[model samples]
Target: MRRRRAAGGSGAGRGLRRWAAAAALVALLAGCAPREGVEEIHYRLKWLYNVSTVGDLYALEKGHFARAGLRVNVKPGGPERDALKELELGHAQFGVASADQVLRAAAKGAPLVVLAQIFQVNPLQWIYRPDKSPFREPADLRGRTVGVTFGGNDETILRALLARHGIAESELRLFSVRYDYTPFYEGRVHFWPLYINAQAPIIGERLEKAGEPIAFLDPHRWGVRFVANSVITTREMLRQHPRTVSRFLAALLEAWREALDPANEEAAVQVLLAADRETPEAIVRRQLPVTRRLMVPEPPAAFGRIDEAAWRETEEILRLQGLIERPVDVRSLFAGNLP
Candidate 1:
């Protein structure tokens, strides 16, 4: 048999063929670009894209929104920062946040509605120093200082967990800790709430790099569950932009699909590391897999499907704990063009 020739040939023909291939691929994709229902949207995430907001960041970067003619602006979140205010103040039209904010906003007359549950299972966790002031569990938190911020449903979660475990708020002291995990390392608090996707890995990798080992404790295993961050929009925006919502969700789901790919793990880590450049790659790698696992641990395979049961369960938890009154519309929770 004759030996196979190299595909692009040599010299000038090789250069010409490579250019032609690149041009053709661009033309093919541009030719397939969406022609209908384009919308300009700003997406302010409740937190940066590390763990909490990676789903949105990945969706935005992968052209999920582009095929649907939607442009999204994803802004990161922080302490004393309100994403809903960003939308209400007309800085952004869409964003991700916890339902607690939605309830608080609705109670104050913002007419915001949750659209999608990004993390179906709560990713909230507790981080402690086993070598220092090591915490065995929530019970160990009694009479000890813990660092936390007053955002989302954090207090409600802790209280609910306390009641179940027969722990008392009076037995523990709350210290304000910045969202970062430094306080735990410095012996400022006995425990701190963290998102396993973002903080856990960052802390783990940083400490490991510094020769400081980190210990993680799942609060949910101890009966602490908080509503995960969710996609939300003002009712006014939704009513005037139903098509936009559908398009946005479509693109977001596509991003989740890419994240679901096992081979894309490293690529996904790079995207996440883009969120916090100060964070090490090892941390990002560790966090991304945990976040991905939450999307759909098992799979009949709906990548970004909103779970009404999960939403209501969270609502019930909030209500029984008096975090919300009556009920918020679960149907209005996540709007889509799906049947």
Candidate 2:
């Protein structure tokens, strides 16, 4: 990682001032609010409006957060948004981030902590027209051209998967991918990274119309369990407003439970369609079930249950890949003490 000039002096001073201002503003606003007044909060998501954010969208639309006395302004994230940075700047009190983002931010001394684990199964996977190339097993990747974002978590995951399966780096062609999925559509890239529920389904429908079937290769299914999206907030926010944190989490988790329930499938899809108008209605409907499976794959386990083992495996993979020089204790970064 290249060192920014802001590492010290004026830059460091500015950052501290911003953080202090944010903290003070939160305290002042919280203290002055009436006992029954709804406290307005901002939530920064990991990506743009999509099915991946159905739980959040549902919560907001269904008045779950309102019942908890919180009026949250849900913000959309994209390639330009950094949830952790927004948290530090006090732009957002809470946000969603991946495990890799948390680990990297902590290594740089960011005062962030995990509030809840949303995705039990990481949806990051490679989608391919199985009939075209037939990616039935990890061994099939050999001699194939695979696409991964050069510095994204998917790179770490794909590398780990290859290493675990004893596939030499020299054997396969690794292609660095951008926002475009043209290569995959053109069949130049055999496998491409995408969220299983989001882009995969959209592409699958296109292939289906063209007489092709799509299948995804998940690292988690192959034993590389990287943690996915989780709720995050700054240490200062957690320390200063314990009740707010608890209420927010409770309502949010309950919202996820309700959204994933089979009875609420139609309502959940409707909420998502409202939030993401570009996604076809039928595609959003298809995505909801796949999103539910990834969010709460393990039965008997409640929604938002933090999988400590998955976090540990995520850290271990980063360490092996030389991403984290000194492993930050995964347990310490969690807000809820995991047993």
Candidate 3:
């Protein structure tokens, strides 16, 4: 959904915008040619530029990938992009995709392997205005209009949440969400799905300005934990270019660590703003902390660490939802140690 802008007088916002603009220029020049002996690696993302991709941008801008002898072409993904399809067609050496996509691809005999888990907690959550018919529990969803992306992961997750709480589909209204947030803005929908870090800040800002504070209904908190974005590559690439995989993972993990570092907050946010000019600087600055929390949920949580249990749960959800007819050996897809 959409929301109005929130006013922020922080000087950090202006500083980041300037740095981001300069960094964009530098990246543009750097993309013109590869450094000597640097192998070109095409990495496709799951979606467009946002806080979700700060680590990827950080790695590119700070020479992390170049330091590993690779010139990565970080491509943005959208409705027209399918990372797994590109990987199968030999278009991209590496890409980011959700766990469900990997599982479904594996079930269909695509030799995809998970390299590292990006989000420790899934960022998909239903946002609602507390002043506008707040839901205290899952059963409270009965008779409420909930917006979900039809045939998307959110649809599956929301269904699972309903089943978990013994709430039947007939009791609630399931509205298909799209790029247009008119229905939500007009108060026709009680809750809407959005990436907590990407769209949440913008929606929350707008709603807050209208005197309606936004709150999120996280499925993870209610015991239905769906896995989010993770790094992926084909088994062929991992086996043939084992060295490249190792180098890429090392650099990538290091970049993620840097992006989540408190000292590097401004730098990371600036990189994201440079990549995605559509999002306001203030919104991006607010998203960085949320991204950090999802990336590293707790202390001693290593960056890029794969949570096996969460993977299993994701597979189960897909199977239960009949998204996949047969079970995919999700654990076998990972090589385990990541740098």
Off by over 4 Å in 2: 1-25, 35-38
Clashing pairs in 3: 3-206, 4-206
Local distance difference test values of all predictions, in order: 0.65, 0.84, 0.82
**What digit string (tens of lDDT, one per residue) describes model 3 on residues 263-323?**
9998898898889999889988899898888988576867888889999999998888777
* Candidate 1 backbone overlaps, count: 5
- Candidates 1 and 3 compared: the better one by lDDT is 3
Q: How much is 18 displaced in model 2, in angstroms?
A: 7.1
**lDDT string, candidate 2, 260-336, tens digits:** 99999999988988888899998888888888888985768778888999999998988777776457788888886
**If scored against the real structure, what TM-score would every candidate get?**
0.74, 0.90, 0.87
In candidate 2, where is summed lDDT lowest over 10 consecutive residues?
1-10
- Model 2 Cα RMSD, Å? 3.1
- Candidate 2 lDDT at 75 equals 93
Off by over 4 Å in 3: 1-38, 337-339
Candidate 1 stretches with Cα past 4 Å from truth are: 1-38, 49-51, 78-81, 130-140, 150-152, 179-183, 186-188, 206-214, 316-339
